[model samples]
Target chain A: MIELKDVYFSYPSGAVLEGIDLTVKKGEYVGIMGHNGSGKTTLARLITGLLLPGKGYVRVNKIFTTDSERLLDIRRSTGMVFQDPDAQAIGETVEEDMVFGLENLGLPVPEIDTRIEKYLDLLGIRELRHRNIRTLSGGQKQLVNLAAVMVMEPECIILDEPVSMVDARCRKMILQHIARLNHEGTAIVHITHDPEELIRCHRLIVLSRCRVTNQGTPHEVFGQLLDEKKMDVPAPYAISRKLGLSPVLTIKALLEELCRSRSGN
Target chain B: MSIEIRQLTHIYDASTPWETIALDRIDLTISKGTVFGLVGGIGSGKSTLASLMAGLGTPAHGSITIDGEPPDPGRNVGILFQQPEDFFFEKTLFEDMASGLLHLGLTEEEVHKRIHSTLDLLGLDHQILDRSPFHLNRGTLRLAAFATVLTMRPGYLILDEPTASLDPKSRKRLVEVIKRISGDIAIIYISHRLQEVVAVSEYLAVLEQGKVAFTGTVPGYLDWATGQDAWEYLPVLNQVMYGLQRLGFDVDLNVACLEDAVEQIRLSLERT
Candidate 1:
């Protein structure tokens, strides 16, 4: 679980986030969206304890991010996948990189091996187990990064634009895996710019100009955002609205709706 | 007026234990004033092909010619790699743009003119030149990196996932910039985002395991995709149209933009 109250963060250059209040309960999937330089990444780092807030506080699992003594506990409870995959590499090979975090956690060797195998297989990267990290493509590196984080089996996973570099197949696979993990009671805080990716989120938070401007269910937030022309939305949702029908998330649902309407059902 | 690639193959760490064939016997042609999309799964050799086209490295086999001559990397072909901002090491964006032009033996006046004109062409303001590239936001940094390349006036451009981490507004802006300048230069737009590829490209090549699985005009590829049942490769609007067609609805599958798709769907429903 994560909570932030009246959180205000600033960089040496200037202020980034202001008067933020948010919480993610256990197993809750929250999506954070904003334009570039809108303090989205800054907020993610604050929650992960990578950076301390300048004015207020960020708490994960009831442990304050400012609590340096319990930073390890905070890290164990939460894992973060950064936007850039190249910056997160710590091992030469895929398997080794995955094992690095588990080894640091001091898990038994058998446990570490089991977790590495489980996640690599889950992420569909088993064939890349021994491939050099440098040789992998940007999307492959991103999968490796997710596998490495998931191996830790943290209570919550914070993904920053996890699918941006991946192909459509891999993107769907990663989102499905993340959703499965959330269903299994792991918290998810997905940060992305793509509105389509947030369709499945339980709650959505919109940030802009250093403040929280919107927060609600995906339908509620997307409805208001679309009306305001403030953000780009998924094609299905946009078309449904244009056709005087309730907005839907996926293309399959939109087709069903269209069929039912044509039949007057 | 065009780039010709034939039997191009590139192998990493050749003849060694770590040898991996990055590309294999790929052939393509990119005419000036066209946006050619190169899409594939991760490690499917999209970047490898881009590098080969940019003359970053020699291919293990086959040939590449830009306007019937070997590609001259900065002068004839400019590549904006993923995370291109990382390549900026100058004190300011202006100096960064100037340095590349300076290396080409251009006079200071010419360098300044080129930078300003490129920025104007990209719809970026001159005020950004005074700021450090490091301090600029991701969107601005990307455009600045692009300006650095466009200032050289390359006949061909290679953009690798230019909109990967960009927000929607910035992504739209960059796509517009690509469309605006695509008239004067051939662009190889490499990305995992199929929607963007569909939006900007006239022709597309889909790679699978270092081989070209499909290549044709945008509409031709869309028609091909509908038959493949690989809905992942198609944009959401196309996917909806494909799904409707499966349910026996008469809709236009070749439509790309949402407005056209919506209109097609409306007409289809009214017909029934």
Candidate 2:
């Protein structure tokens, strides 16, 4: 639902993104991976219309980001979770922050309440509903941010390193929730540095020095990146590749592959 | 010398309906020249404990002492908070790095030397010192914040989620810097990245509900974690190792590195 054609963006300091071309179809789970200062965040902002492209154009659901009259429609169709949780929190309490967005959307109070409860429970933060957003831990605050975004129920959600602040268990839970949302036809643009988190993504795009250096399925991109020693592959996939077996993404898949190979032998 | 924490309890919004125990009677010891990893689920008190240890505030019902005295953040204890770069108020990075050192009565030459040396240790060039800290990239800003802490020459360092938003290369560089410095100073390396914790820490402590759930060597914690079936909290290699063990293959569960884990799996597969 999001498309960027010949995108060029620059700040007063220097150019951040140059001649970038990308597209995210409806319900597509696209992962954007890159090193720091690679304009990944800039690209996200470009798609969300927070920062307009200096050259070329960005369109969400056929509405150009430059179209000020339709900017609200673009925002309603897409949601973005920032990397820093504290930056996104506006309300004093978790429930208040969640309701603020729904209220802005002018949804009915009953519907807003239902959405607030549903997302808090879905993210396992129901107990934190009344907690001051500032008092919560970094991980907790990040979950609240995700919940706030998901409560919007936008057509697509762009998450910027959503799981980086969370512990392993919480990371898995958040990823599962994101996957579930994507399964139900919500587009996902997951920006992260962790390769393992991209294992289940339908497509992977690697950004480097203001360019899309690589793009393909996770396996193809990771395999090529690993071969070129350009990126760090997840341990399971790396190990499986080193052993002359087809690379698998998750530990469970790696284990199954190992066992099946042994049985074949 | 070692830092000792006993019966430490910290509560937020105490005496009110919103009062909550962030850390509950936590006790631990961190010796010099060791990397002690603190890990937990969300709101498990890792950051609270780190702040208490860093002397950010006093605990409610217990004590934290570094060599028989309260932690002195000025000289002997340094903390790199989650958003450490926010603490950079000086116009230039050099001024920021020198701010803490100047309070120690060090000569200007020594302060500059320390700042330069710290930057060198982190593989940063001296040319950036004149630039505004706000102008640097996220990775550089993180390293600059880290440099500010190290320039003080603290005996104990507390890093809270140091690699949270860092890329893989930056994460590796930071880990290397930690290893190079852990020989001279004790470090409380707190993070949710289990694999990184396992790689860098000699000891591990798991917290749950503000209580210390497990604390021991990294290998011991790994075995304990596997037994507890907290596989979700394990590194990918460890999870694979645990999975292999369940599939009736004899593999080393404590294999932390990828090369070692691969070797262990290869030998186990050959034997089976």
Query: Highest DockQ: which candidate?
Result: 2
lDDT of 1 by residue, B173-235 (tens): 899999988998899999988888998999999999999999999998888887778898887
Clashes of each: 0, 0
Model 1 regions lying over 4 Å from their true place: B13-18
- Model 2 bad stretches (over 4 Å): B103-107
- Model 2: per-residue lDDT, tens digit, B1-272? 99999999999889878788999998898999999999999999998898888888878999999988898886779999996777887888888888778888999999988888888899998998998887788898999999988888899999999999999899999999999989989999999988899999999899999999999998898888888898877887788888888899888788758889889888887876
lDDT of 2 at A163: 91
RMSD from true fold, candidate 1: 1.5
A148-239: candidate 1 lDDT, tens digit per residue: 99999999999999999889888898999999999999999999999999888999999999998889999999888989899887889999
